[model samples]
Every structure is written in C-alpha cells, then in structure tokens.
Target: MLIDRTHRPWLIFSGAGLAVAAIGYVMYSAMVVGGPRGGSAVGLTYGIIGYAFMLFAGLIGLRKKYPIVRVGRATTWMRGHLWLGLLSFPLILFHAAFSLGAGSLTRALMVLFIVVIISGIFGAVLQHFLPRLLTERVQLETVYEQIDSVRGQLLEEAEKLVADLRSALEGDLSFAEEKQRAMAASAGTVGGLTFASGLGASEFTSQIVADFFDQQLRPFLLHSGGHHCALADKGQASGMFSQLRVQLPRNFWPKLADLESLCDEKRGLDRQRRMHHVLHGWLFVHIPISYALLLLAAVHAVFALRY
Candidate 1:
C-alpha cells in the first residue's frame, strides 16, 4: 500500500506506547488491588488515555470535512487515525480490566465500539486497493458526477454514426442507379437487366443497417445503466461490430471501428462509476455507527462517574 512507509513510524510509536501502558496496568493491578478493577485510579487513567486517542482519531474525519483548517498534513492525520485508533481498543480493554462491563449500557457501548473499529479497519483495507484497481482498469475514467454529460455525448456520436451510415448507403444506391441507366441506354435493352446488380441491393443493405442500429446500438447508447446491455460485454460487442462490418459497405468500415471504440470507452466509464461507489459505500456503514459508538461511550462515562 502507498501508506506503508509514511505510517511505519506512527505504527511503531503507538505499539510501543500501548505495550508500556499494558505493562504498567498489569504491575499496578498486582501491587495495589490484588486484581485489575475498572473503578481504580489506574483504570481511570487508562480510560482517559484511551478516550483521548479515540477523540484524536475521530478528529481526522472533521479535518477531512474542512480541509481549509490547515492543521497538519492529511497523511499524518490518516496515519494517526489508523495506528492510534487500533491502539485504543487494547487500552479500552485495559481500562475495563479486560472484562465486559456488568451494566447494560456498558455492554451496548462495548458492542458498538467493536463494530466501529471493525468497520474502520474494513474501510482502510478498501482504500488501500480500490484506487489501484480503478487506475489500472479504467483508462478513460472521469469525474463520477460528469458521467451523465459524457454519456450524452456518446449517445450523440452513435446517433450521428447511424445517420452517416444511412446517407452513405443512399448515395451508393443513387450512384449504382445512375451507372445502370447509363449502361442500359448505351445497350438499348432494359428488359434483360437483373435487379440484384443495382439499387435494390443497396436499399436492402440500408434496411439491414437501420434495423441493426434500432435493435442493438440505439438501446445500448440511449439507456442509463447500459452496463447490463449486450453491447457492454466486450466480446459480444466486438463480434457484433465485426458482423456489421461484413454487412455494410467496405467504405463504412472505419466508422464502424470508431463506434466500437466509443462503446468500449463507455463501458470503461461505467466500470469506474461502479468502483468509485464501492470505494465510498463503506462509509455509509462506518460513519453513522461511529457516531453512535461515541455517543454511547459518553453516556457510559457519565453514568460510571455518577454512580
């Protein structure tokens, strides 16, 4: 992951600090209370320290929301969020004397805290790899929000291609008709001429092209979520275009090739959209749960102090 080297020092520092705190808690428990107890002064110290780390980790989210705050490098804040956030778990366990609290509120806080930590870890893992997947797989990637505009442009191009194909085919038919008339006039015999060698064949070809566009290309280009369409599949789209090249005049082959490329680019953009959604989707689960966890922890702390 790109974050490895930058986060290494932070990871080490947090790990060492946690080890020291755990050892100190162990020694104090052995010397003082005969066992670790959450009500003890040492346990309260561990709780305060752990909660401080948690608060710092949570602030990273605030920092992201307001980048203009200019407190520190985002990378530094991210590293702290990752390493110190992980360290908070063990510290909180130490605070509770490695026991689940007896009260219902404390149990709920523990469950919520575990869910938040697990979701954060899951999100961090996704961030590490999803960007690389997007870069390698989506060469024509654009801003996700701009996809609709780009899609409309692609649709316009596809429509223009169909129009050009029809125009070119009609022009071919007119030329063939003119040439046949010239031949018949020279020979002075029209009754023996076969219809297959003239305008009728070109008209047939135009109809075939029009039908293909209406049935296949139009739906693929004009619809939202064309990713589900047959043309969105690379092999199928390529084969369909190959068949089109065979059916259309050789002169129109280049335009068919260009259309194939546009389709592929549209497909790539769709993939990028899906991947971008995946990269962010976890936050929907993580953020709200984290806020809930924090709120529960605050309430638990208040009740503990009062009772």
Candidate 2:
C-alpha cells in the first residue's frame, strides 16, 4: 500500500486529463453526429464511457502490480479497480446505444466489448470466490501428492515380493493355505501392506486374482482391506467436483493446470494468471477484428464522401 504522495502532481495531472475527456464527451453532442444510415450518437457515447472504465481498470492493475513505479497506494488502486469494473459496462453500453446492425465497425466493436466484459467478469470471480477454494484444494493436492510419493516408496519395499514368494514356495505352500496364512497373518492389511506411512496397505493385491507358479510353487496372496475402496465414497462426499475426479483426478487436477507457476510463488494466487493470460490473449481477437471493422467503416465513409 505504498504511494509516493510526492507524485501527487502526476496523479492530479492524469486525473485532470480524464476529467476533461469525460466532460467533453458528455457536453459535445455535435461531434457524435454521423452518417444517416449507420450508428447512433447515444450508443457511441455509452461505448466511450465503458471504454473509459475498462482503461481505468487496466491502469489500476498495472499500478498495483508495479507499486514501486505507481502513484497510488494498493488500497486506492484496488478501489479504483472495483469501482471501474462495476460501472464501466453501463458506460460503454451507452456508446453502443443499442445499435448493432448498421455498421461493420460498430458490430466488431460490440463483439470485442462483450468478450472483454465477460473475461473481466471471470477475472472478478477469480479474484473473489476462487482463492479460498484454491487454498483448500492446494492443501488437498499436497495430501494427494504425498500419497502418490508414499505409494512409490511402498512399491520400492514390495520389491521383496518375489524373494518372499520363493521362500514360501520351498515350504510347499498351497494357494489356499497361503491365502489362509496371508489373511490370518495380516487380515486387514491390503496387499500385505498398509496405506499408512504411505505404505501401510496396498490396493494392488485385491484388484485381480493371484497366480500360482510351478517349480518354486508358492501360495497365492489374498486381498487385504484397503482405504482406496472408499475412493468413490470420498469424492462423492466432497461435493466439489464429482465429475472431474474420474480416472486419476487428484493427479490431473484442474485448478493447478490453470495457474500452476503463479500459485507456486504467491499465496491467494487463484486464477489471476489465467485471467491475465486470457485478457491479453483475447487482444489478438480484438485488435485484428477491429481492423476489419475499420476497413468496412472506411468503405462506408468513403462511399458517403463521394455521394
């Protein structure tokens, strides 16, 4: 929340320029007079106002992100951002003035405005609601990664499977007898292991039938009760994302995919990175299309000039 009050001069100056633009737009009706066939004076006014709001929001973001170079405090910048987001839509729509069909440039700008507005709203949702959810999910993700890593360690330990099988075979262990022993020796331990310590019980033994080999004939292993049996139960209980948890949901988590690198370096990160990405990315949509609209506008303008 640092602002150099000393830079008040610049802030006042820029703000004064904004005031001038706003006042001029509001008072200057004749400037908006256009061709009889296309566009509306009132709609253009609304569009300009909305554009002003959008521009201010962009400025606020830029100032906050680069506070050292900013002339406003974080709180003030945030206030500006919030107010602009709330008010700008109506301002720009005034520019549109409900006229969509009469001009190519108007239609193009309308599409751009709609896209920008929707993307901005999504950004707001990310800023407000998404951070808390992401925090809980991050903790949950930590747990899942830890589980996977612990499962890996258990696999390392389970490497003793073949050697243990050989020794048991030498004792002439029958498949039924081995099942009895493995079950009795470890009734609740799944795969003769546990999920605790990332290695307490494994889910591997219960999923399929065990094979009995000859020569070094050993008794087949039996299923031990495991927590993974409740995976479906756990997901259903969460109520967060039943649809996404399918076939390794924890590993291929969705939120992380949107803003992974940013989340690592910052807290309360949420989908800001994703929002910024889309905002800037959508510029390609806006800029090039604006050109087409301008081209058409120019065609209309030239046709009018000759007549």
Candidate 3:
C-alpha cells in the first residue's frame, strides 16, 4: 500500500519501539557476564518479543485468506504487517545478538528470515509504485481475472467489423478466378489493395483488409500471439493502419478506425497483464518462505528451550 499520512502513527510507533529495544539491549549487554547470550534471561526476553512480532506479522496472511475472521480493519492489519514485519528483522537481529547462529537450525532460521524480509521489502516497493504506473498507462484496465474474456469480446467486435466491411463490398463474382489472379499480381502494391485488372476497387480493398486481418491482426488478438506480431509495437501498428487508411476509400475509414480502437484496447489489456504480474509475483516467493521461516523458528525455539 501507498505510504501516506495514514502510516504516520505506525511509523512513529515502530521507530520509538526500536529505540527502546536498542536501549534495553545495550543495558542488558553491559550488565551480563559473558555478554547477553540467547540463553540468558534478557536474551530470552528479546527472542520471545521478536517472535511475537513475527507471529503477528504472519497472521496478516491468515487475515487476508479468511476475511470472515474480522478481528481488525484490513488497513490496520496491513499497516501492522508492513511496519511490524520490518521491525521483526531488527528485533530478530537483537535476539541473535547480531550473530549469524551457533547451530544448523538457527542458521537456517536466520537465512529464511533474511529472505522473507528482503522479499517483503521488494513487494512493498512494487506495491507503492506499480498502481500509479498502471493507472497512467493502462486506460482500458479490466479485472485481472477477466482479461481473457475481455480480449475475446474485443476480437469478436473486430471480426464483426471486418465481416460488415466485406458484406458492403460484395458483388457478383463471375470472374472470381481472374480477380484472385489480379490480387496476386498486385501483391506488391500498398497492402496488396491496388486497382488491379478486372477487379473492382472496393472488392480488391476488401480482400486486402481481410487478408491483413487474417495474416497479422488475428494473431495479435489471440492470447499468446501478440508477442510476434507487428501490431504489438505501437509505432509499427500505427504505421500499418495509416497505410491502410491511405490505400482504402474514405467510406471505409470508419471501420478501419474502429478496428484500430479494438487493437488499442487489446494492447492496454496486455500492458495491464504485465503490470499485474510484476505487482503480485513476489508473493509466490515471499509467502511460502515466510511460512517456512515461522515453522523453522518454532522448531529452533523448542529445541533451544528443551535442551
């Protein structure tokens, strides 16, 4: 979430808490005999409080997963997650006495904790910036889950436009073979829509538009096809559509304009898809590792206390 005025109280609280903990740790370290080790009363107190913060941070995931358990407002939970989760890192360091670890389990816990904190920070940074970027860039944004359905709708609308253009140009094809030959011969012309021998200008233009749609535009509209198409590049698509406008009659401009609009919307959807992935993909790493960290930490705490 954006770091705004709402975060002021949490920021102040986290900063003050860290300061107090630092003072306590310093005093405890000075009074302790062999230094404030994990087994000492003061060290144990640090570890317990640090772990409590961690547990609280982890519960945010559960809070999100089951919204029915309404213990607090989501914004409050999120603020706690961000600030307390960050606070946990330093508190954990204090618990460890700034050492990596004395055993394999402790070392593993430290590693996992470090990974979790780094991933959380990365995710927070993305969350802070990507929403604004998405709003500015993807004017046609739809719900992420509905992107495919929206794309399909856009494809259907484009297909209807092409079909209507073709229908409007339809006439008796007594010399259909000759027309095809003429189209093939004039393939080198602007989008292959030249006024060829024995072919009506409208018929030839309609055929060219249909061919362009099938060969290039259709793939661009498909879910996995845009990457390889010229239409995927804004500059190239604009140039191609401009050529179409110049080659075809003014009466067909409206349909071409509508087709371009559909393509633009499809591009916006593609952009939103990419931005959405960037915004959320880190959770795949952060969430799983966080759960593992908590589990391993619990194991360490039990073994340390018991043995």
Candidate 4:
C-alpha cells in the first residue's frame, strides 16, 4: 500500500475473514481425516481455491499491461491483488497440509511459491515507501521515461549559456584591447603616459570559464547518473562555483549563476533517475518468478491428478 492514504479497509477485512474461514475448514478436515493429507478431498478443494486466488493476483499484471480495459478502477484491482495474493499463501499451506508433499516436484513447487510470495511482499514494501521519499526529495521530478531527453535538453541549455558567455567575454576583451591601443597611441603622441595595466584580465577569465565547462560542468550534466563528477557532490560544486565566481569579473557573475542553477537541476535529475530505479527494480525479481511459480504449479497439478 502507498504511504499516503490507507488501502481499502473492507478488502482487508474480507480477505482476513475468508482466510479465517478457510483455516477453520482446514482444522475440521484435519480432525475428520486421519490427518490433513494432500490427496484428501478437502486438500484438493483448498488447492483449487488457492490456485484461483493466485490467478486473480496474476491478473493484476495483465491489467497493467492493457490498462484500457475499464472493468474496474485500477486501485480496486491493486488492492484485491495485494490482499488476495497474500491470502493465497495461507491457502496453499492449507492445501499442502502445512508440510511439503512426498515428492521432489512438490518440494520444488513449494520452494518456488515461497520465493514468489517473499518477492511480492518485498515489492509491496518498496512501493509503500519509495514514492513518498521521492516526492519529498525531488521537486524537479519528471516523467521517468523522459529523463534522458530532458537531460539532453539541460546539456544543450548549458552549452548555449557557455557559448553566450564566450561571445560576451570575447566582445568585452576586444573592446578593452582596442581602448588600450587607442590610449597607447595617444600617450605616445603626447609623451606623457606608459602602457596601462589589466588589459588581459577578461581574456584570462574567458579561458577559466571555458576550462570549467569542458572539464567539470559538461561531463556532469551529460551523464545519466551524477556519481562520477565532482559537481555531483553538492558541497564540492558550491565551492568550485564560488571559486570561479571570485576569479571571473563582476560582469560575468550572472552567467556563472545560470551555470550553477543548471548544475543543481542536473543533480536533481540524477537523484530522480536513481530513485526511479529503486522504485521499480523489484519487479525484475517478482514478475518472472511469479510466472515460473504458476507454471510449476500447473505441472504439479497435472502430476497429482494423474497419480
């Protein structure tokens, strides 16, 4: 269940009631029969009901695959799947008479079922907490599938910013040099002044800006995960940008600010991508094992009936 609102209470109540009823039936069978044997009539009934619940639980995945089918609200199906899937384990245990059956195939099926249940529960727990964590942390949250394209756009924006800064700095440097030349020529004619200093400062600042982008900002923004870059470390990025701000002229501060903002956005995108992975990673384990469990259960059913 999600961390925000509680899941439907009635669903939980109904599943628990049914599970309790099934448990009572199992107890009755245990008393009536010499013991709760898997091949007994009551045990077969439990197996059929347990398999039905498993089928219903598996349909939730199918429903997700084709969401256009409006049989019911998705939340309804998910709630049912979660509760009934949980309930199926107890039913299957009842079917097995709380023990593995007398054959290797039965034992494998039981092990597979246990693994499937554990994976499903693990996935449920992740779904419950990870979304809330993401909401709290990533204000710049985006559709996960679009993260790559968004990242490319961010890189393009950063490149354009650097290009604009380069153009501005070059223009300023040219104007400064031209002014110094005029001053030099006038002073030589007048024979009253030597060459003025600080003519090359803008040029030096431009080089620093270019190197900063090429070495740090560009690589950090372009990467999917920000782990390898120094700017990925917020403290390091802040300090590096602070040093660059002190080095560059005051006129370039606005552009430097924009670059810093872009870096921050890139860090948010990186965090979002990682959290998205944490959110969905468990499906890799839960899904395939579920199908395998169902297939093995089918084979076991066939063999059990034949014998």
Model 3, global lDDT: 0.82
Candidate 3 lDDT tens digits, 1-307: 9989999999999999999999999998888888878887888888888899899999998899999999999999999999998998888888899998888888889989999999999999999999999999999779999999999998898887776556444432332335433454443222222223323555677788889899888889976437789999889999999999987766568778899998899999999998898899999999999999999889889998999
Which candidate order results from sorting by TM-score in descending order? 3, 1, 4, 2
Q: Model 2: per-residue lDDT, tens digit, 19-44?
A: 65456545654465552222355444
lDDT against the true structure, per candidate, is: 0.78, 0.41, 0.82, 0.77
Taking all chains together, the TM-score of candidate 1 against the true structure is: 0.84
Candidate 4 yields a Cα-based lDDT of 0.77
Checking candidate 4 for backbone clashes, the offending pairs are: none
Compared to the true structure, candidate 2 yields what TM-score? 0.38
lDDT, residue 183, model 2 = 48
Off by over 4 Å in 1: 32-34, 172-201
Please give the lDDT score at residue 168 for candidate 4: 48
Cα lDDT tens digits for candidate 4, 94-165? 889788877898888888889888988888888888888888888888998898899899899898777656
Q: lDDT tens digits, residues 177-218, model 1? A: 344445532332232222333333366677887887788777
Q: Give the number of colliding residue pairs in candidate 4.
A: 0
